[model samples]
Target: MVDYHLHEAIKEAGLDLTKEQMVVLKKLHDEDGLNQNELAYLTYRDKSSLARLLSKMEKKKFIVRKPSASDKRVNQVFVTSYGKEIFESAKPFVGKLIKRMEHAISETEKQQIISILKKVQTNLS
Candidate 1:
């Protein structure tokens, strides 16, 4: 419930996001250093979208692309110093949202609920 609301609340809070941009940001937030394809798969975004967002983010000085020494064809995404600062600033808001989620249930209940949701996901698969 809270997870569902969180995205909407984020939008309501005047945080701007193109669909792909949000996914890219969230994916990077979770798992850094992913290649373009890997990042797209993880975020369920298309390559075209990633390309555009990457371009925009690069221009904004939020992220950098470094060529992989092992694979010349790929560039790993790394957050820049400014991106780190932005992420740090957003952490408190995320923390508050998490706290609100925790308030609605006990730790055990939260675990159980997440387990159930995961099971449902697996069951669908």
Candidate 2:
């Protein structure tokens, strides 16, 4: 499975991307300061599960969740300096296959592939 291959690649590359940590960090990278609900939707993680993961990340000093002044019920999540450093370190390793993937396919084909893959995902779900 691709998941197995991906896990092995991360291990072989000696990257520090725990499954939950990687998802949350990547979600933040793409869209910073997303509240917990927004994060759960973006990352496809349930709220309670994400909460536990966020708690651990907070303890590690990788992230901070602060209550919004505009809305006391809403808490915004932010990656810390340490998280940026760690995520930056992981990016190259996680993206190691990109060069090969791009090299092996034409630009047009890449677009077509992505379009077809999206349809496949929709159909499967």
- CA lDDT of every candidate: 0.73, 0.83
Q: Residue 36 deviation, candidate 1, in Å?
A: 1.7
How do the residues 35-97 of candidate 2 rate in per-residue lDDT, one tens digit apiece?
999998887778999899899999988899999889999999999999988788777766875
TM-score versus the correct structure, for each prediction: 0.70, 0.81
Model 2: lowest-lDDT 10 consecutive positions:
1-10
Candidate 1, 64-113: lDDT as tens digits: 88888899899899777776665655555666777876886888998899
Candidate 2: residue 98 lDDT (0-100): 58
Residue 56 CA error for candidate 2 (Å)?
2.4
Q: Judging by lDDT against the true structure, name the best candidate.
A: 2
Q: Where in model 2 is the C-alpha error above 4 Å?
A: 101-103, 121-125
Q: For model 1, which pairs clash?
A: none
